[model samples]
Target: MTFRTRFAPSPTGPLHLGHAYSALIAAQEARAHGGEFLLRIEDIDQSRSRTHWEDQIYDDLAWLGLSWPRPVMRQSERTKAYARAVAQLTDAGLTYPCICRRADIEAAAGAPQEGVPQFGPDGRIYPGTCRARVFPESQDHAIRLNMAKAVEGLTELSFVEKGALFAGAHRLDAARLVETIGDIILVRKGMAASYHLAVVVDDAEQGITQVTRGADLWEATQIHVLLQRLLGLSTPDYHHHDLIRDDAGKRLAKRDDARAIATYRADGATPEDVIEMVGLTP
Candidate 1:
């Protein structure tokens, strides 16, 4: 099969230097392999995702000289696809309704046991309060995956990145793969789809042969891979690149507008400079 990769960005805020780096790398890699580079707008967060931000994504990416293969895909318009996948998972007994609130989890897991609360790829770890409860037919709650049972029939799970900074091809951590990510949420309380479900379904629908994103999402790949297996979808090879961090070593966020692409453009910084800022060759 021909090589295909995508740079999926959530259009909730302005594109930042970090976004530039990832897009450039993905575009360059696709070009290098004579592959197709696609762009996907992860606008699942309807509350925060705005038309302005979506337009900014197109403008910034074009300004940075990063071209997409075809017309971009917006996740907000693909609710029905995500809903279908969720229904399939629910039918397979892989998903359960989670009624536990954030406060309940925090109160249940008082005080840090060992240093800070152990966090995996999907942010803070869930204490699994609603794991045992049998969700009623009329129960209105978020859906959670039965990760423990899901990974039982599976033997080995791994992926490879053709190019990487530290390890060219990284291996998946087996022990932490199952333990750290236990019963992750698939659908939010009122939201139609969750990140895990949406991402996997979108990736499959887009025929993403490989995924190139920040290393911070490395752990989350396991969840996606697991979902692929559960849904009988093909898993793509993954490349988790080093994240762009600020001087304080925190990952660059949308709140840091100073690093926004618009700011850089206004400050007379060229697209090449934006690529260089991400430690990539312009």
Candidate 2:
């Protein structure tokens, strides 16, 4: 089978070293296997996405000697697709409307000492405040996925990574995905769908065979897998690679303009130097 992968970057900010590292790794992996590499603009957060940043993405990738197979796929242009997926899940009785705000969920669930909320990978685990509420005449609130029924009887969840399969079951720690993430926000209040829903639809639409990115999103794999099963879409393999950090070991951020690809390039850094900086030798 032909291998297919994608480098999906949100255009909310400039492309930093972490972004470069991830994109290069995906590109190299595809080339190494004589597979296909695709570029996807995950600009769903319309509030922050900017045309300037998008242009920079193209410029930075080209400067790094990376090329994608087709015209870039932009998520902002795919809202309708995500809406359809959300509707499908809702029709299947796998999603519900959530009225709770972030603060409300945190207060309801009580504050945990470490990490984010246990439900879903996002950590802002919905406390299911509206789970028992009768479906309001109108859904003015965000929608959440009803994972309780969706994952029933599935004791083990596994996916392929780095030519091997890794399995995780039930909850990540003390919080059960079903109860903690019960009725996750599939749609944000006025928004049609959440990132989890849109991304799953996009991945399947793009025919992506494997997903490679930072390990920080490891928890989100479960959310994607559950969505795929619910939508009857094929689940792709996942490889959560290590994150690029600074001398202090903090994960790279868009605010770290000092590490932006454009900044490094202006400083006379070669593409090979960028690869070396990110720990990708090729």
Q: Give the best candidate by lDDT.
A: 1
Considering only N, C-alpha and C atoms within 3 Å, which residue pairs clash in candidate 2?
Answer: 143-186, 144-184, 145-184
Clashing pairs in 1: none
CA lDDT of every candidate: 0.83, 0.79
lDDT of 2: 0.79
Model 2 agreement with the true structure over 200-247: per-residue lDDT tens digits: 899999999988777888777777777787788897887677889999
**TM-score of candidate 1 on Cα atoms, chains taken together:** 0.91
CA RMSD (A), model 1:
2.2
Provide the TM-score for each candidate, comma-separated.
0.91, 0.89
Number of backbone clashes in candidate 1: 0
